[model samples]
Target chain A: MKENIFPAIRLTVICLLFFSGIYTLIVWGVAQFSTNAGKGEIIKQDNKIYYANVGQKFTNDNYFYSRPSAVAYNAAGAGGSNKGPSNPDYLKDVQARIDTFLVHNPGINKSDIPSDLVTASGSGLDPHISVQAANVQVKRIAKIRGIAEGNLQQLIISNTEKPLLGFLGTERINLLKLNIALDNLK
Target chain B: MNTEITGIILMYAAVVAMAIPLGKYIGKVFSNEKTWLDKIFNPADKVFFKLSGINPLKEMNWKQHLVALLTINLIWFLLCMFVLMNMSWLPLNPDSNASMSADLAFNTSISFISNTNLQHYSGETGMSYLGQLVVMLFQFISAGCGIAIAAVVFFAMKETTAGKLGNFYFLFVRSCTRILFPIALVVSILLLFNGVPMTFDGKDPITNLQGDTVQISRGPVAAFVAIKQIGTNGGGFFGPNSAHPLENPSYFTNIIETISLFLIPIAMVFALGYVLKRRKLAWTIFSVMTIGFLLLLIPTVINEMNGNPAIAKMGIAQPMGSMEGKEVRFGSAASAYWAINTTVTSNGSVNAMHDSLTPLSGMNALLGMMVNCFYGGVGVGFLNFYIFIILAVFISGLMVGRTPEFLGKKIEAREMKIAMIIALLHPLLILAGTAIASYLYAHSPVAYAGWLNNPGYHGFSEMLYEFTSSSANNGSGFEGLGDNTPFWNIACGIVMLLARFLPIIGPVSIAGILANKKYIPESAGTLKTDTATFGLMVFAVIAIVAALSFFPALVLGPIAEYFSIY
Candidate 1:
């Protein structure tokens, strides 16, 4: 028994190192094995950094915008605040977010708000907004970015992700990737 | 949205079927008696014990040992609960959210503290920063618990008698501070590089097309998500779960999370076998699990990608397969992959809603959580696989007309009976619970029954599935079932205790039995369990045992949909 036990402990250690070594190798492989197709940047403005890939631009043209967040992330603090909408301060914060949006883009009606717009996301640091929210901004984005309105709308349409096997989540557009691409257009 | 209740039930069943072999493979790995792997890590274990101020040389029997281990764990569990309860006053509260309700907090505390990250509320508004730190921190610790338990079991059966059972706090701390944390940190960085956001401040409101101001939400997501997957905590930081663009961010990030989900579970098997000096034995279990994962994931993704003819008839042109509740970035294949990965180990966070999947696809996910999720928790998964090995030795010994011996230890009648009891416990809990719930109570605590939300057989199945999942420490729930009732609450509590301990007791008993056995000399005629042939036998035993226990449940759940899919 004594003979067997010592060997076993020794054996277990080698096994752990070996597997972790392989995992490290595989992870290294994934890091080394990228398609190298696209690249993006995290551009900061007004203390908030949005994802900005190279060759991409933020254009209002034909893109939909999703909901607003009270507490948010940008690559660094990218997680949800886990704050509920029912907090006494929650709605007040939403109103403040609405006011901020008005300062950025003047002249949208309150009724045109996307459901996700006022609602807190599971993760406040979400990179994609609901497609519905994106559509709420399509006309204004189209008018702002100044390409043909239909052409801009087509871009947002192109970015939308359909649900899994046709039925998991609503179609969505990546705010970071789309905004970067939008900048490229202009 | 018309909830496809039947479809969800089907996929749930199928996923369970795939998980059984996974359970076996994981068990076989950590059962090693001695290897180079053990020699290396054992020192660290000793160091940890000494650092924690426990004597490293102390030796205790199984009962005293479990008591110490459980006492330590219970203290940690309480500490975790305390963090959640007091999140409102914590400094990590960048969002400054309120503390969770007592019930909700209890559920969350146990859910994540057990490595079963089932959320009773939306993430964005439910928890404060401190709650996440404590609860999600427990995710790493919980998996460590699984790993440490297996390590203890390993020492128990290992021929060596010297050395501590291992420093529980060290195992917990290292798993978080070393393995899980570093990987999560790197993965989060990569995710950020790939455009996933990470921030502490709120997103500033930006004006949109129709001129309405909308506050775009953002937070410290990348790192949290990275650890969530690594630690096998599927509780979404976002309310919409992983599908939220904020949570998932990019296709690159998606791939990282997918791979991370499988990382520890798969590697543990390698470690287990290597330590046991039976790498091939581990490989066999791995093969069975990987094959099962591929089988379920591939077909589920394919079917979902096929696009629902129902929608096509209306000329809506479903975007290539089961796109409902899936991210456009990931599409069907990725969703299928995520589904398989999550349920492969009882981590049930989905990028897409299982409630909306196809009947067959849904069944696959369900089956994985049920049976194939043998790799359910980090350490527990392998422990289950060990039971299968013992069972295989017993059955095969009868077949070849020789007394069954595993690793030169005789497979006695008592050991066989104990192994068989633990082996069947999961299915028994899952099926019996499902049957009773479906037959007696179909209404969720909150209910409005519509055809889309059938409250009969399908609804009942959902309730049963959720309970089975929770008790089994599998976190995936049939979201359609309002399972927050006292019945579910109490029943699941019992189930969790039983599911976790039954399998553990089996192995502990075996280890005790093995501690007394004398090693027999290997002979040419001795059928070695460490070989490829034995691996296949072990694999067969796991598959057969799972089939026997849950075939009826499958027929009632996922297989029923297989017949229904026209």
Candidate 2:
């Protein structure tokens, strides 16, 4: 009985770990099966959608406008521009993005611009924006609607997140939700 | 950076003060089993005793409890060994990958279970969601196991009149249910509040400006980071590690991360002294570990603060000394803190890129890993430190011509042999491993080119540091070594196992032996372990051991690196 007790305890611990390992394998298989789908599925933001190519037009009017992405798919495959932060090529890219922003955002000036809107996030496909980024476009959107800028500001205020539960991500507007809200207003 | 003054000061004050009180409270609570907490934990206590076939109702001499606990931990080790071998096929893999190769798998299992978590492959790239769950889940349990063991030992030794080695089951259950769990809950809620994503979904792809769809990584990251910090298991869910913006997010989170790295370690040290009536004993041990911590920390801080001179000459600001491998919000001080904390505790999680650290700064980070103190990680550090303390007790015993005794337990020849083996194994790996790596280069082609081209003092140092850190379970690397290959991987694997189990087994056996002996009352002639003089001796012993084992290697590695730049 004494000998059995020690062996039994050892066997239980070993068996528990052995099963946990097997369970982990099963869990890995399941997570992998679900993993290959894509980020939107992983994050559960199915409402968020975009074209795979830059030239593809986004004609949805009810969705909020996202910053134009210059990232391209090519025969060469996927990657960032790889331009150093201070490179002229990078600067020129930024200039071109700003021009596009200005054309899309009529009557907006340099003073009202949020740098993040013009600049790409590190991963280059950010779906959210700094509250400041949303606000810069707020004035233009309000003017287009012939509404009070105050109401537009109110719209942004209501949309701003509290950050991760209370302390994680920076305060920002969800680009998808804002566009949907715009349609609701009409 | 300037605007967060009130917050930073408050954080600093809170960490320093709250750390002391929290530590003292844990110490007092675990001193004996009289609190309300005992009632709640008693059930688990009873269960553990039954599982071990021990009578919870029957009092055990310390030896019996030690054997039961040791046997349980050994079973856990084997379980990890088995689980890691097959974790790749498991679930939650946003990225489907297979098991780490045998040696690396073995090392990684030991790493996390030991509260080391010194990972070779990036989490996002290498592990499935299930692997993280199974492996990291054990991190929490093993971490709790270590803390409980430490508390049990402290409670055992603290009983001056009659040694009441508190129930191992009670200690294990309470430490997990009470301490680790509650802290993890608070931190997770706070992190979730801060906008760190907490969803459990598969990968989500978004079309990009470049006209290609990009797959974004996602999972139960809040759960991962919470335990990573609380358990002092620092592996991140993503490849870029904690540096990934999604994983860490912002400045407030950054500070919280820093505090998480140091909290339990600091508390454990405080508990050590409080266990003995001489509160100073803990401080003495703290002083040795702190000195080792600061020796590396200050240099890394200064070098990083100085900025790369080349970057400065090229008209770049170098971003205030944290330009390389660091986020802008954290700046230099916090990065320095992470580098130091992980190395001292052997946690191996990094907030910045070690490769980009100024040469001297990087060396300090690497060296700190070699000197991983009793603060190394959850259950492991105290075991390592106590071994040295035993050594110090014996060595001093020799000086005075008395038999060595610690905490009313006499240190014998067998115990000394175990301590010597534990101390020597680390150095042996450093010297022997580097010699072979350097020697094999003449016949092999892999490591011959990159950093080893010159093959002088500098190349040797990098190899030496690699083995030293790996073998010691101190996970930081020189980042210069070509360690991603089979030769280095397999070599590091052997070193990792030897450095890991040899250190653990010796002390546990010693603990078992000590537990069996009848307690000897303190005498006037017995050398007090809790004194400043002894603290100094402890520091010297630790320093001398690190020096004796790896100093020659350090001379070749960092010393040569310094000469290379000059």
Candidate 3:
């Protein structure tokens, strides 16, 4: 055991240097060529900067509300509600979200609301919502912004992201980008 | 089929296709054979040995290997504790995160060094950049350590006479440099392009369209995430793990990360086959593991996609299935696939929250850890399966009234005793740990009221899953449990230590003993271990020993919850 100790300590130090120092430096160097130079992808809109991938809270009636967040879309410390499927209090929260969505968009029934819009995501900072989730909110946004419902529908269609390779994921729209596009519309 | 279903199928295909060749490469690497990467890594490895003053040529028996493994792990544990506890004042702490409490540090350090990675603290606010890097170092070495010990077992199995197993440092260094490093490099770059942050810069505060100011946590995520996936460490750069958008940016990245979880584990099985010159044996083992894996996976995918029936009772459409704690980009199918894969491999990184999964799916995840041998964690995974193999060989030999011999080495009473103890240890730790926590909670509900986020059956599952994860060295959790308190921290730390070391020691000791025994040539009456019948025997042993032991505890938790919900 004594004989193994020195070598163990030595090997660990060398490993710390190689893996923690050298390997990390190599990856960090390569990231210099990536989006936003690997600080994270950023969007500059209306003289304000935003993380393109991180979700933002958009509760205003004029904007397309992002999915409910457990951390209130706090990117600094991301997490989910971690609510179990059968938790009565959690179910109450989901039902409350449904009722609120119905109240905000009078014409749309509760059955039309997508679960993504009501339930909190794992990361709390999920950037995208399903296309169905986006479509259900068209009436609320159109009325609040005094824009034609067709143009809002057109905007949803144009912004909707197709699955990878046309058949590898769900169709979804980034709510932050979609909301930014809404603000830009005449 | 819908895109979600197709996506999972393609990911599985990609992993198996890639693992076959990677397995061969790994086999060659451990055997000291010339490989394509040897020109580059040979000199690099020389520098490491020289710096460490370790003579890679000095051979060690299994006892020596364990000594080296445990000693180095202890050093790492101390170093990790120091960094985690002092990172607030350490260099490179751009986030200004506070130092960890002693109990939290104990849990975190043990968690990473054991390769279980059951995080008691959220990464974004809880860890500094320095702390993250130190944790990342453990991610590489702990996995390398597991792989190296496995290489020793492989060597022992392949030996025809009593001889020293290869040097532990040589195998361990080679694992990190030759195997884990290069793959992590490629995966890191892929993640970088897909927008996982890799800078040393601090958090970026931004204003959204709604004019709300939010602080976006950014750091050396790309480098951290790559090793986290490849090593089966499953520690995350952020609290949400792969479910976080930045950690796993898109579906394409999701496919890349998910494939990585299964890559080294499946490859290790094939590596065993290559080293032993027994392709049929490898295939039999792979088939049995795959069958066990699929049994857990299929039900989970169905349940997660079917959505929560309780949620369905409310008037809303769940076309995307159980979206609570799941992202839209990956959807329910891929998330369910990941849940089972992560648990089965002991990778433990979740793309979706496990606590939010439907009850049966949650049970399947628990069962994956309980059955813990299906494609298992890096090198240690195969070691866990080795115990089952030993037990199977012994039991079958007893049934057929023949002496038990594995690859011509007799498995006597000593090996059987060791295997039985190790096999029983898993259930013992999980059941006993959960019992204590449950007793504490039941006796004083108000005192421990904060312990659970959910009430009743599902809450009971949170405690059960924690110990099962710790015992299996699989780090993914139900996450709803308030686990940072001293009770949980100390309890799980000890469990992880015992689980990680004892399992490695048991298998290696057995293999070392077997390698030293007199070789007996295969006779007409020798039990054919490589055959399908033998595979069935091994499967039955695993089912009876690992799975059945956890049945009552599971019934009380997930099964009861499943019936109550549906």
* Best model per TM-score: 3
What TM-score does structure 1 among the candidates reach?
Answer: 0.72
TM-score of chain B of each: 0.84, 0.86, 0.99
lDDT of 1: 0.57
lDDT of 1 at B176: 41
How far residue B341's Cα lies from its native spot in candidate 1, in Å, is 1.2
Candidate 2 per-residue lDDT over residues A134-186, each given as its tens digit: 76676567767776778778777887765434433235565545554564565
Query: How well does candidate 3 score on lDDT at residue B269?
Result: 95
Model 3 / residue B551 / CA error / Å: 0.6
lDDT of 2 by residue, B203-250 (tens): 555663323455555666655677677676777666445655456656
Worst 10 residues of 3 chain B by lDDT: B157-166
Report the candidate with higher DockQ, 1 versus 3: 3
DockQ of 1: 0.06
Q: Using TM-score, rank the candidates from best to worst.
A: 3, 2, 1
Error of 1 at B472 (Å): 3.5
CAPRI rating of model 3: high
Ranking by lDDT: 3, 2, 1
DockQ of each: 0.06, 0.07, 0.89
